[model samples]
Target: MRSLKNAFAAALLLCSAMASAHRFHAGITDISFNARTGNTEIVHTYMAHDVEALLANLYGRQFDLTDPDDQDVLRKYVEGRFWIGGQDKARLPLRWVGMTADPEKVTVFQEIEQTPLWKAGAIHDNVLIDFIPDQVNTVNLNEGNAVRTLTFDRNQLEQPTR
Candidate 1:
């Protein structure tokens, strides 16, 4: 009995430590970016599972997760501000940002934190970010100063092809 208790206690401690070390943050999902004529278009999405769990993980409280409300909160924040390249903030800070949602989908487009593809771990969710905002713009961007850590589960990335 004592040996069993000792083994359980050690297992519990190890599990706790690992969980703390890798609490899921937030990051971009199903995202694509394109630029045209000095105007940039950033497209990113959120999964139904992400909004509640990831937000609660980061903020320590469950936000009002209504489809429309969740979409709005996320859209406004990304549109209003983003870190881009060497610039201090949103490269093309929008005058306005918009959100629209159906039962289980949210989409956003606005100025984004843009970066080059060579960056290691340079993308995140909870915000919109564009890659190579200008093919001819000739500016090399870095991802060293991202605002939030985004998490994409291996399970999702490894979904069985249908």
Candidate 2:
């Protein structure tokens, strides 16, 4: 019984430490906005999740974005981790500071921090992305339709379509 308890405690400690140590994918892409900018640059990183549903989530009312609540809804949506920058190349640890958005651009900024996965010094990544927010997102290439998926294109984004 004592050995089992000790083993369990060790496993728990290792797991908790590992959980906090691992890095996660995070960044801002397709950033675009011009409406709200005061204390910080408001940026937007489009997410595949439906925007309409997000509006209803923020202020407890259906939002049309073009309405007055547009900015408020956007602010609420990106409060924690609503923006999707699509920069999944590396496991990035970032704390979103401010945001803004429009149909053409979505940007997010985080203080320079250690990118443990990068092997080098801090990544200092303030990703600014400019791309069409396609609703038809992509899964891994094994699922087929590699041409449609954004991952392949993002890596070699400038390459002409063959």
Candidate 3:
């Protein structure tokens, strides 16, 4: 009977640890066009722990996000994964501005300097889908007064920002 109680306690501890280590696969991206600046702003937010784990798995080493080298790697990764296409189907250039990391989330700021003079465009956001199969990224495109939202996962890679 004592052995049974000890086994139950061990099982409970194992479950608790697993729960604590589990990562939520989700991110949010807000895209807005500024007529005054003639540029498009992008703010991408993700859970810091999830991003760290994903980068660790990809690079075969743990990344300290606060480190400049680690941040450069992350910035490069994001630049390649996320994109916007203009009316001619040409990819819009995304320039990484900076990033902010809180305890819970990491937010990246980017901008498309040459604004596309189109009513609609295509947005490709594959943030963590390469490392996380169950990853879900929600993108909000704000064009003038209208806001359009699209959710991307493993199945859907890009969506029209119309």
Top TM-score prediction, candidate number: 3
Badly placed stretches (over 4 Å) of model 2 are 1-44, 47-53, 57-59, 62-92, 102-107, 116-162
| Tens digit per residue, CA lDDT, model 3, 32-89 | 8878888788899999888888888888998777888889999999988998888667
- The TM-score between candidate 2 and the true structure equals 0.27
C-alpha TM-score for every candidate: 0.36, 0.27, 0.84
Q: Which lDDT tens digits does candidate 1 get at residues 1-162?
A: 999999999999999997786343333433223333333334444444444454566568766644567656655555443323222322333322455434454555553334322222232221322211111111122223433323334222211101
**Pairs in clash, predicted candidate 1:** 26-150, 27-124, 27-125, 28-124, 28-125
Better of 1 and 2 by TM-score: 1
Model 1 CA deviation exceeding 4 Å by range = 23-39, 43-61, 64-66, 83-162
Candidate number that wins on lDDT, 1 or 3: 3
Clashes of each: 5, 17, 0
Q: What is the alpha-carbon lDDT for the whole of candidate 2?
A: 0.35
RMSD of 1: 13.0
Candidate 2 C-alpha lDDT tens digits along 43-158: 33444234444455545786544444565545444443222222443333344565444453334343213322112121121221113222322211111123222231223222
